[model samples]
Target: MPRSQAETPENETNSHAQKALSLDPWEAAYLRFETPEEEIQKFIGRLNRLGAPQWPRDAEIVELFCGRGNGLIALQRLGFTRIEGVDLSPRLLAQFKGSAKCTVADCRRLPFTDRSKDILIVQGGLHHLPALPGDLDQTFSEMQRALRKDGRVMFVEPWRTPFLTFVHLISEIPAVRRISRKMDAFASMTEYEIRTYEQWLGQPELIKKIARAHFVPVHEHVGWGKWNFVGTPR
Candidate 1:
């Protein structure tokens, strides 16, 4: 039998998108990467609105592909103490916040019961998943399934803009690379980062279309060098 649409790798991504498929050791090392503290605060502030009227202090929240559970800490500060994180990397999970639970798993196949979670946060993780053409839908399906009737997802990913595209390209110049190496943040490139970023171009728009087909968009944000979405399952 032919593979189901969910199982097939669609002609979804172009040749350049091939980069989002897998991660190497250095790229794997990159997964344990730290998220800026201010980003965490922003997520909390968004949630404050997301949870408006009632804070949902007891809501069970989870971050898919969470690295080091930095986001879990943000939820804690907002009084949502029942938070969890899931990722494929044990190394990242090991560094998760003290009270948050961490699980090693794929976002396409979450272990949670149907409609068990209240909120889902995907900070900087949306673009790094399976880059194959048809794979993005599977991830979206799982995200919707894991949510309660009112469950929602918030996503923040690096934006694919011409200026940033030029920036990444110029940063690759040998002279620029040498100078960047002097500064730790841009000191080196991860094979994984390079590949997925190439595939991520134009994804924010595509994600919005797919999200609206199955869910409703509470907000669609694009700017600040990134794209963010607050979506609720339909």
Candidate 2:
């Protein structure tokens, strides 16, 4: 996405915020390597592991930071008919192939009415937010506002696990990058997200604390460089 011309200090701030919150050009380009079929199956596996099979198929669902709508397609395949997606990147949203409604909007400021949504899902997105507790708090608050009393929220994000630490340590080695195609790709992706990724990984405990403050936990798993959390509005 092109940055808006900064006519004033406020515009500069908005530009910075947009940079921090949305995928950069290179990151968006990397997404093209991900096939729709593969992404759908990958999301299906994640949802099943997160207990999505128990969720009401008819419930209204919105996915924040939904890039290319693979997760939305996965939801449809799982029998969900009422689904929508919100993201800041029009370029990524344009790649969506499914029937779900897609909206270009910031996740911290959702467009849905109060208590109107039945579920919200976010995958691999929150780490992009630069502001730590404040941005996280605002996003969760917005989530609560959009969710019904019984509504649930689910997310999968990077965590600072031992394996991840080790991976990052060795990912810097020239030999590893040249020898492993997967590692090479991973390194390229992480290079684009290094700033925000470091910020988010440094506060894993705080992230969990903030999440728990807004929602009653239904399920949570932290390991293998990923944090998967499921909860209902408090």
TM-score per prediction, in order, is: 0.74, 0.85
lDDT of 1 by residue, 1-234 (tens): 887665555544542244333544554445333344755776667666554336478888898878767678877777777889998876557655568888999887889888899988887776776574456688878888889998878787778777666666675577776555322233243344667666776566676677687678887767746776787898
The prediction achieving the highest TM-score against the true structure is 2
Worst 10-residue stretch by lDDT in candidate 1? 181-190
- For model 2, residues 1-234, the per-residue Cα lDDT tens digits are 655576677888887667545866555435644667878998999999998888888999999999778999999999999999998878789768789999999999999899999999999889988799898999999999999999999999989889998998787788998887656657777888789889998997899999999999999999889999999999
Give the alpha-carbon lDDT of every model: 0.69, 0.88
Candidate 1 clashes: the total is: 2
Off by over 4 Å in 1: 1-54, 166-170, 173-190
Candidate 1's TM-score: 0.74
